[model samples]
Target chain A: MSLSARRIIPGLGLFVLMTVVAVWALWPTGGKVTINDRARDLAAELRCPDCEGLNVADSTTTSARSIRKDLLRRLKAGEDEAEIKNSYANRYGESILLNPDGGGLGILVWGLPVLLLVLGGVGITIAIMSRSRSTRLTPTESDREEVKKARGK
Target chain B: MKYSARWIALSVGAVVVGLGVVLAMQVGNDPRIDATKSQLVGQPAPELSLRALDGTAVDTNTLLGKAVIVNFWNSWCIPCRNELPALKEFANRYRDDPGVALVGIVRDDSTRAIKAYVKAEGIDWVIVTDPDSRAALDFATRGQPETFALDANGLITGAQIGPTTLRDLESLLGSAQGR
Candidate 1:
């Protein structure tokens, strides 16, 4: 390998390693994710049904406060997250869920964007690889003479 | 992209657009929009047991087999006062009906103010106070003058968000009776 490539390859490897370490450090550890954390996150995702432009966690409206308390209580009582969310949906309708689910019609809202991005990446990769592999003709002495004549003209 | 890949993407694009149109149509006709117009409608009437202004205990659950009209109001709300005359008349008319019960629950007002208003207005319809608005939140009430008419089976048959007219109350009661 060339001197530049050797230096670049090691540098790139180190950079990738550091990025992975940083991500691992910053990523939420499951051990630290308590019911309170889940409750807070759930509240953040619940739309304050009686308010404009505020989630249950952010809104101080009576309805918002009530739901927050209800959520925490239910969470503490051993009900799972999805069941609690479904109960809220049944009570307040699905609009109360600010974040759509990953499945069902909600897939259109979430999965479509991710799928499109992946497809776009694949398309770009294929295009670049195809262009690189395309045939290239080498210039003969006569071809070089013709190019020199064109430049002179 | 390869020809096959291009066609796959195009097909995905077409399907997405088709789903988009369907979703848009669904949103346009969504009954939830109207469902939230009065959130308590089509929901089971929440249970409430309270002490009336006259020191009498009133439990809504006991009256489950009868048509019940729950009126949420406050002393400070103008609409509540405006609708009181009709509510009084409605209550009077239903007093001997045996099949209907009208109960008024105070909201967002002090006990003193409500007592004053209830006494001064001669408002005699089983007036009760909802502390901390617990019952109100359960009923999904936005504000004062919200009314819910519930059927014998505990389902809320109809709801009104604003001031109740005699006609509106009558209509709601009729809906509760499956008329």
Candidate 2:
């Protein structure tokens, strides 16, 4: 009917659509550890010795597959994630873990993302403030009087 | 000249559209396991020297001239244990076949336990023990019950993780022979 109503209707529809999509994307797939999920998780943790910088989960190498199988077995046995990881660490050293543990140099890995987010927010705020200051009109009394005279005329 | 809000919105929309297109392309181009060629198909088999239960050595290099199937397994592994009967039978069936060799690599398990399991199962194939598991790492073995099919030239032709059927083994052997 009205131009504003038409614009509002589309914006509302878009908001609903976006909300639904986000929920669907973030919806829990039930258990945290299905057979495949555990396999994938293990794969992500275990480094593929054959493939540089790629975890077993991401690597298509034969070694990775075997590592995945091992991970699956460990998962099936009701072994906790920490124990499974420890097992790998025992055999292959700490480098086997894709993400380092949350201590020592590993702490930096986890902390950096948070630090970046905070810095980004601060940078954006500063940028907005700087831009507004540069573009803002500072009206003198003479300019205001001229504006008042123009309005009167 | 300064851009309008409309231009900024358009740029953001363009970026979102570009990201969506890239994601779609990636999903579309994702290869099925069968469609993807195995990288290990032609690579030299990883060298390993592990001792058999009888205190004898089973070396990959020594088996270079023969078509060998190196099966990594352990008694503690359920899948490995589950697949033992089928593997034993397969090994038996192919035992007389001079072109085929089945060697089992025991990973992260004690020699005594492996020997007991092999004896209980009556597994007649050559079983090797990787107590230190250095051989396992060398073979890039992730877990037990993984098999690598090696050609006569000691090049790995196929690798199967988890329990595989006899049919799977035959197909792998067929592929190795270029049949």
Candidate 3:
């Protein structure tokens, strides 16, 4: 094959491999279990105070540890998940939860990421198309002459 | 021009790979359980105001003249529940000592639950409630069953996180008494 094509092929392969690996490595495992089934279900919906990105069960923060203990206690006491979470929300406020109740600013935080991703994809597509159009050109006589000379050599 | 573009892409890929490796390392290093050793020793005791179970307000100011054992706990915490009996015994043993006072700070728990737990466990210390959890925030407490021994000057002489043994309690009390 041509030298330029050979060089480009390896780079493209590396790029694709890196993208796949990045997505795989960073995907959330959600190692959720049913220790206190009711509490686990509730905790799955609650955000961890120390590590806000994860649910309570998935977090290892001291606060999360305490919160999980409370959840289990409530569960064992025959309190349902909804009742327990509601009690916690009353005490600590709704921001303690991972999933915000529908409506208001909570919905906005949830929606913003998807909106940005769509906008970014559209912007990239337009930029790529515009760039390709601007850079494209018909081959000149000098280019053809060079190719012919090179082929002959 | 083509080769340069390829080189740029490859460099970017390398950087992304390096970043991923660093993040993975950090995640791997994350501690699974809370460390039992105290991080608050040598630091000044955090200011706190909590209402005793008897409905009297207790603050750091109240602890000024005496060395105090400030135990952060909650009725909902299992480890705290497990450690309460030992704490109760220790407080009882030191009850008559004017130089040493044992105080319990109920963290982020309901007053009703705390009262019930205290009653059931026969905990006789000055049990207090931090409904706002201001004390927890100030102490940077990650969970329940953390104990801090403060000198007469209100400086933290020693601290212990998680469940406390009778031996740990005695050593802390002994050190505070000695100071």
Candidate 4:
């Protein structure tokens, strides 16, 4: 209802909106997860050992084809996503997954960027808040006396 | 705009993070290679049964109590061709050694092509045809010229990728406790 209140509300709304946009844009991107796409999606995370820089989902090599077939079979057998992934990892080690694991040294690879982004956001918000506070008008002694006189009248 | 310490810190952090990622990608990274050898080693070799070109049944169970060397190859693979001579020689040297067994599983090729290559190379060892490549897949074979060395207990003791040599086979067989 007050003038300052209205301005502050819109500014807060804008800050929140910008944050949501940044997170949505910078967060990890993955395809839609569905039963039909499950096998293919997991396959995309596996690299073809026979081919250079090719994922199993995109490779026609025998190794890739065999892995894809096994993945599909496991999926149909009602295996959990992590179970299927670990199956390959058990055989191949952590490197089998296209995405690094969230634990161990792999945590650094997946976490550093997110941590930096959040830190950057917090830093920017602090800088902006401090700048705004410094520039805003502060009530002087004369201004306070004028306010008191107005209140008395 | 002046570059602040915040920006410099972020830049340094980013470079470090980038370097970490690049280094991580290079470490233990062999996407093309499945964990077959690592996982299968110390575990029993998967069950396999295939008929040779002569229509004789070759079963893994029968080959127990002897060190089994299962070599997966295809006629189309150049490395497979190159490794054939060494394999034949190894088989010949160990022909009288009942403790050693060398078996070749032909993959992804027609019986005719496999038989012709076997006869031309005089492989002489147990050459079996893997009709649908089911056996090779069971062994987690990535491509041609991958050989698996199994101990007398049927446990996989060694896995060699690429074109293998006589020395490779010797080393594998040498470390095999069964031998």
Q: Record all residue pairs in model 1 with backbone atoms less than 3 Å apart, i.e. clashing.
A: none
Candidate 4 lDDT by residue in tens digits, A1-153: 975677579889998999999999999777766665888988999767556678989988766777788888888899978998887776666666788789866777787778777767766766655655565678999999999999999
User: Best lDDT goes to which candidate?
Assistant: 1
lDDT by residue for model 1 over A1-153, one digit each (tens)? Answer: 974576458757977999999999998776778888889999999888667778889988766777788888899999988999887776566777889778777777787778877777677667755665667678999999999999999
Off by over 4 Å in 2: A1-153, B1-6, B28-38
Best prediction by TM-score: 1
Q: Write the residue-wise lDDT of candidate 3 on B1-179 in tens digits.
A: 35544554565566557656655766744333223345557667878777898988898898987878888888888898788778878887888988889998887778888888888878888988776466764565656778888888787778787888778888777666663
Native-structure RMSD, model 2:
14.0
> On DockQ, who's better, 2 or 4?
4
List chain B TM-scores, each candidate. Answer: 0.79, 0.83, 0.78, 0.80
Q: Once superposed on the true structure, which residue ranges of model 4 sit more than 4 Å away at CA?
A: A1-34, A136-153, B1-39, B177-179
lDDT string for model 3 (A45-67, tens) is: 87675453788888765566667
Question: Which CAPRI category fits model 3?
Answer: incorrect
Best candidate per DockQ, number? Answer: 1
Error of 3 at B41 (Å): 3.5
B63-152: candidate 2 lDDT, tens digit per residue: 877778788887988888787777877887888988888888876677778788888888898888775566676555555667778888
Where does the lowest 10-residue lDDT sum fall in candidate 4 chain B?
B30-39
TM-score, candidate 3, is 0.51
Please give the distance, in angstroms, between residue B134's alpha carbon in candidate 1 and its true position after superposition. 2.3
lDDT of residue A4 for candidate 3: 56
Pick out the ten consecutive residues of candidate 1 chain B with the lowest summed lDDT. Answer: B31-40
